[model samples]
Target: MLLNNLTKKFKHWLPLAKSKIEKGASQLENSINNYDPKEIIPSKLIERLNTKLNSLPVYESYYDTLTINVHDYIHQWIINKEQNRKNCLVIKGNCVDNLYNILTSIFSEKSSLSKETIELDYQIFSLENLKQNRRDRLNYLQEKILEIQQQSDKKIILIPDLSYYFSRTIEGLEVLEKLLKLLDEDENKFWIIGCNHWLWLFLVKIYHWDAYIENARDLPLLSQENLQDILLPVLDLVEFDWNDLRRFLVELPNQNEDDHKIISQLQAKYFENLANLSQGCLGTASQLCFYSLRYVKNEETELSNLKINNPQLPDFPSITQSDRYLLFCIGLHGHLNKSDLANILGDDQIYITSQIECLVNLNLIHFLDHQNIAINPLFYSKLTKDLKDNHFLVESD
Candidate 1:
């Protein structure tokens, strides 16, 4: 009886032990096969941090109202011109990005009219070749205007950044005034001009640009919905994992039908926060989104395991009286080279250099090129408001 009982127990234990051995072999094989010589395993804390950053939005598109309105304006202008009306359209905006979008949209043949649209980057052209070819620049513009005037088919002449040539000096302002007068005299060609709102304001005070271009429109501010529309389409093109994003806040071993609903609500809130933080400025919103994605607390860690924090607007440093004046000067001109800034401030280059470096470190301004510096777009709208409130800018009637 004892022998028979022992035989039965062994029979039962044999299969159980074999199953355990097979499971162990399978796990060992997986470990060997998955081993990578170059892979560095991150700490649990770092892994958690990286997982958080992967949840934030990445900026992918330039969204705005300017592009759509530009197309509509050009089509309307062409139609108006056909009725023997000689009208010039001036597009003025606070942001250079908006102005650039309008110019590019018109030039890309987005309009209904099939006529040729000639585009000029007066700012870049003036900065590069104007010193050696000032006469050439003027002549070139005149020739384009004259050529478009003679064409039987409707042609549009676009001078984006028209205020680039309008220097604050007496002689420079006079030259710009004369050029506008000449353009105003032309009754044959359809002209579309893009000017910075600040520069436009200054020019109006000096030369009354309203008299020269009777039809002027400000680029409309983009709403939160508009910003969403621009970003979602781009997001669709990429291989984005909603699951990875959802895992950031709530960890579910398996996805359920309600997971989609939860993730959607979270995403909406995230984007809404972004829109509010940027104050409906598309460029600022874009920059903020990009910085959030690219930001890392520790540079030495692997990018895949890096946790990124939501980017916040810089707390602008307290400005001295002189720094306030410097900011106003830059805002007035849109952008200024160091030499031009020195001239405006009536300070020596060495003194100006120290000031500019301080501003740069404070993240109030940035270099556009080797020498030219401009106010940071993120702070531009607020800074302009402060300047106006402090009586630095002239109030409009």
Candidate 2:
């Protein structure tokens, strides 16, 4: 079901201004802090909610939706393979869509129903550890490609996250060209490559990468319906008492519908705002959903009160242009370690470390692991616009 026009028209797209983000964040914080202790909802319900949320994989539901369309794209290639023998299909995912994980989940039992004996050779190219010697690192992958080339058998090779295989710097660009050349030359080996949207755009501009791929599909932007699909099943386990937002619920289209349908609409709007806030990123939306949940037990009204607080992107802290460039680079690569990020920026490790710490403090970029730092999904919607406004060549998606 679609969100009503009123909700659609009012979808909040926060601006690039640090002050505005900070102000909204502050307001949300105040509202939460001011909640009465006597009105505190039970910890038991909170625990139960946590259990349900933890059970849901990062973006399995959203990825399931993505797979349907992706399979269609793959199916088209399967049918048309003999006509042109064109092999690579690069998928460009919106900056924060967890596109990498989506690619991995494509072969789930539910999606793998096509009785096709496609002996798929899948490789996730993670070049994080090979920073010191990319040339050698690529040699191993190159050998694998060459081996596949020698095989007369038709191969369906999947390389999820092309961003992992190369750095965004000049050296990375040259390496990408070599890798792409190997893939392009072997028409028999149908290659399916997944890449970050911003990185794809950057490559397109630099190398006319789009021309090389010839076949590309961008994952669709998630909507409130999509967000609710992912969330409501989990939300169903806990009774949420959205007292603060009760007044805002619109009348259902028909009075004869279930009287409780109003509750569902309110929940839908709750996720609608969330989808807008997170800009269609399931990971961000999930985190926001979890944090925004608060328990309230108001003596004034006897009700099960699992509250959903309005979530805002944490303040866009004041940052220098250098911070923007560093953040953008991290986005382009999906994630980059301090050394690699510094290498890309041509800055000293000491200087880059300071910037990384400052950004982590500001909730801009966060460490995915001990070594890799990536843009925080929570701030993705605002940050992408921030980068674009600064003319950082950020992807439009």
Please list the C-alpha lDDT of all candidates, in the order they appear. 0.56, 0.65
lDDT of 2 by residue, 189-288 (tens): 6676888778887887767776667777776567888778777777787665754556555543354556478556667678888988877777678667
Q: Which stretches of candidate 1 lie over 4 Å from their true place?
A: 1-86, 96-98, 110-155, 225-261, 294-311, 344-347
**Each model's TM-score, in the order given?**
0.63, 0.72
Off by over 4 Å in 2: 1-85, 108-113, 116-140, 233-240, 247-259, 294-306, 394-397
Score candidate 2 by TM-score against the native. 0.72
Would you list the clashing residue pairs of candidate 1? 49-307, 50-306, 50-307
What TM-score number comes out for model 1?
0.63
What lDDT is reached at residue 387 by model 2? 77
